[model samples]
Target: MARPTLLFCGLLSFLLSCGERKHIAIWEYPEISPSPEVQDYFGTTVIDSYHNLTDLEDSLVQNWFKTQDSLAETYFLNNDLTTQFKNRFHELEGRTSGEVRMIRTDEKGNYYYLRYDEDKDTDVLFYREKGGNLETELFDPSSYTNEKQNISYLEPSYDGTKIAIGFDPQEEFTSTIAIYDVINKKFLKDKITHINPDFGEIEWLPDNSGVIYLYFPFVEKSDPKYKKHSFSVVYYLGDNPEKRTPIFGWDKTLEIASDYYPKVKIGSSLDSYIVGYAAKSGIFYDSFIAKITDVKLGKPNWKPFFKASDKIYYNQGEIREQYFIYRRATPNGNELCQVEIGNPNFNNPLILATGSRENPITQFEVTKDHIYFVREKFGVEISIFKIDNQVNITQLSPPFVPGYASFFGESVAHNNIGIGMDGWTSNYIRYCINDEGDFTNESILDSPQFQEFKDLVSKQIMIYSHDGVAVPLSLVYKKDMKLESNNEVFIYVYGAYGESMSPFFSPTYLDWVKQGGILAFPHVRGGGEKGEEWHTQGMKELKYNSWKDLIACTEALIYKGYTRKGLISLYTNSAGGITAGMAVNERPELYTSFIAEVPRMHPFGLESATTASSTSYIEYGTIKDSLECLGLIQMDPYINLKQNKYYPATLLMPSNSDDRIPLWDSGKYIAKLQKYNLAETPIIMDIDYKSGHENSSNYDAAMDVNARIFSFAKSNMRY
Candidate 1:
């Protein structure tokens, strides 16, 4: 008898391959694989590692890249590997996921939220109706968990009179929040659309009739094309329907800030005022205190809360169009000050922080009694700083997890306070100081998914950077899990621009930890946690301060017996991709593998955003300044792929239609590595088709990718 042939052998085998599957995406991308034309555009030469005298020689990049196929085919094939790895890792990671929706208070003042149950394939809204008596109802039902369209974005208002519901129906798109009046049990005819951009937070103004706060983006009246402009307008509830005021709008003349926008953080105690940041371009994001005294919008009661200017050009010759040369760029960044919001501009705005390495202060907020903001430390966690009569920096946890904490994307309200601690071999708890200034409560609200693994320890140590700076290191290792003094480790770092990571709690315990994994974090001089003083250590092409810091952490992890060099792995996302790719190029011995997921690796992709893209200026420095060219050269990850060494086996994960980072990053980096790298490492790629900027898909799809990541780790670390 002839051997039974496998059904659809080639096609089925490809589908069943570790990376061939798809999953439920949180931020679903319409395009996972790019067109051949797009791939052709992402051709590359090489991104510098250390910039040696003969770095340009063909021999330098020979083995480092795997350029056997056309740029498109190489990325397509490699992404296949990445997907298989992620899919498997997803399944192995088990049940924990980040899918929280509405967070509200119960009758007894306890917290409640909406959660999506993947197993049940339904959206459930739970409310703390009574003491310990949580009431839950099925909100939405689907065959599988949704990727981007989540129920959490829809929130119910106080007294249950109304609910603000978000609706993003189409793929690679977003929808508006429709008010569902519970009392009337009907959908309110008057809807607020095109107010705040999707991902913008929604706060109910005092009056139940309508919203107190409105987000009016900058409108280019002259250009009827509705050009994507910068600026924001705050709307009040009592406006004469047709004449709502634009709380914070701007004219194009302001070179620093072309349009209008709102602040990153917002807080409100009454229907009276909402304090936030307005879009006034340039380096400065001055605070604005908008007091809604009346609903009749009157030129938005014009006020200026904060403002600052930066050097027209960075050190790399006016910062514009300058090819990035590591370790060189403008020394000038931003100087932030507190602005009194009541006039055309903030009066007596006190300077809070200055940008030496990159942008000055990123996030700031006024809680019940304190003004809290994060200062970008040079390539580390943002030092939690409080400003009142004097600036007080609080260490919430050991410097480890990236500082900018968000329990959920888009929504900013989260309880990210408290501290977590663990011993080298045991005991982990989240600790925090109460208002009275003492470690009052334990931060462990939820138990670890796998405490049996021993509480992962996160501690700080000093690491040596290339420039000899004593970098602060963050480490998390399983407690008493039979780990060798120098166990195989996975060092994760993101040292680009001035963004500092923060430490918070989560159950992101996944497949790697299941098999005895250790994580390492480092804060180098390229971030802003130390204030303008520290941030200055990295910026422009001199931005190497961050790269140096990342490498230092890897070397430190190995030297301190936290890990073994040849068995270690490096994992990073976005800007962190720069860290992983560059460090592997510079110090191959420190790492054995890497994961560069949806990184902004393509330098040329930093081309200016069209008139309609809202986030055009956030990642790539604002293009108006001629000097940002130098900064891009330095900060863009794709521009700095290193060559000339035995690179770690790297897995590149890029969303096919990534809007934020753009797919060019993955395409160009992969192309360059293929054509360049001196080491012939297996540069596997996981190009998530049907997903874009976000690696979210339906439920089954997500778990599959997670499963793959775990399996990949196991397969690669036997050495």
Candidate 2:
């Protein structure tokens, strides 16, 4: 008689023996209709078979998504892990107090911030006056409408008499501006719609009579140019929003492209001049300044302050007295500079503080007495420095170190600044820095202390890539946990737009370490970890460096005996899709599973006439040029998939209402993977019908998705 075969293998047994027989679930992928389409990119013919899946409006695509969602649900139900993870996640979340963000203090010492309300299950705007013990509920999204809404942005007038709040419906990009009278305790009748606050803030005039903001012409998502052709307009109190005057845009006298987004910047309420500029994705753009009086008269004479040829990145500089204090790009790094506002000279300016590659200046603020700036080293350690009128720099000794720090609030008038600091093992704290350089705890919210995270440890190590480049990799796990080949590792990646994976605390991440798992964060080339040079090495024609760096980091983990092959998982979202997707495609045996949320798997799709494509062409090359088209093809994950290849299990979470990345990118990529992969692993696409590119604001909805992700990772890594 033959020996009885085991249906499921134990974790210890599977880890001890490489030949252990583990039961792997072979999912029956849903059948998708193939609508073959071919495109010629400078004589290069690329054929796409699952082009029909891009049309989410099609009935066949809709049914296919439903079927995939059902299959994923059944898999999770059969494994019986989602509920366990959900309960554990909730327990971990309950251990912490609500979060507070966008904290602002007016000249009158009134504090305004958005705080998460446990009872309301959403963030609520709260206001507290000077020397007040009680906080007042200024605006509640729950009270506004039955549908879920969020306060995207808020700005208090210079006089602290009125507040401009941008209210955005959940899963939508457009926002409406509403003015609230702080003294009167009521909202104004004038309502401004079709406003895009993400591009800029609500800049108030010196007298606080109105606000200057970025405006969008189209309000309906069905419009072809819904988020395009944005212009800066001024809306006055008690005036019709339809009659708002356009100050700066491509249609105006300004020399800006149609795809360039225009924004207005008012340094201070006392300043007489305002700055205007047009940018594609970054701050390196041509900027101009004009007198507020001339702008109000609709006959402004715009003078060039900085041109795109200068390669200067805007940092919200201030206009003090007769001089404009700002930071400009230098060969070494960023340097502080000041020029006369009346007759600005870009060719030369007074340099105050200089930065080096090791400690580059990240943010700065101007005050009546001094200029304060923050610098970072290797994206981990932060230092706050102040420059005197004599160009002397002094580093302030804050209580927090080995963390991130940023300056906020109006420091020019009050001579007081708000500093936010947080680290990987520590929670976020707000401090008020006085003119005398004294740090005071100004946090209004309190967080609960959890014992489970007491033993958590984070280590920063540099791993050499295949090309001999040292990539910074961050590891987080229990301090007493033993490092071995059988350890389960989860690697998170997002290496685009020069965004850095800075240190920040998250209870959800801690929950993973609280269990016996290792969390890894690789500061790859495309990010701003090292500086602009690091980003340049991983973008456009050099895009392969990003994924190549990830592969090196993953292999280093296995070689270092921290983890083994088929025991690690890779996860990423949005533009980082290029990094994670390509890594898994190149070496599928390294990871047990892959998870992507709202991923940009198809880079060629960025050539379409969409807002995402227009702004992103600066980061990722466009298909219009032959050289750039070849680069886009090389980085396109969907186009690089191979048939008869063993691919790890993949779970793709995409929202139908995502305005940033189209659903087609995820749809087509997963459809082809499910059809071509030789492995029996599942390729699932879970669609969120009621959310956008930004994660869902609904607490339960976010928890549900996170639970599924963790559960899927756990189930796959068990073998």
Write the residue-wise lDDT of candidate 1 on 481-539 in tens digits. 55455476766666544545545443333334545677666765545444444544565
Per-residue lDDT of model 2, residues 1-719, tens digit only: 01112222221111212322234554567777788888888888887778887767788787777666666655655555678788888887766536676677676678888888888788898898865768898888788878867777788988888998877555567768889888877889878887767666788987889988888776566667767788888878998767788888847567677667788888677788988888777547789888999888776777777887765666547888899888776546577788898778767888887777656776688877789987777677788988877778888989868567777765456676778888788777778887667788775656567777989988889999989989999899999888788788888899987677888887777787888889999989888777667777888889999999999999999998999988898899999999999998899899999999889898876564343425777787877778878888888899899999999989998777777788788888998999889987778877776667866445666777888887778777744
What TM-score does structure 1 among the candidates reach? 0.67
The residue-level lDDT of candidate 1 at 706 comes to: 48
lDDT of 2 at 706: 82
Clashing pairs in 2: none
Candidate 2, poorest ten consecutive residues by summed lDDT: 8-17
lDDT of each: 0.46, 0.78
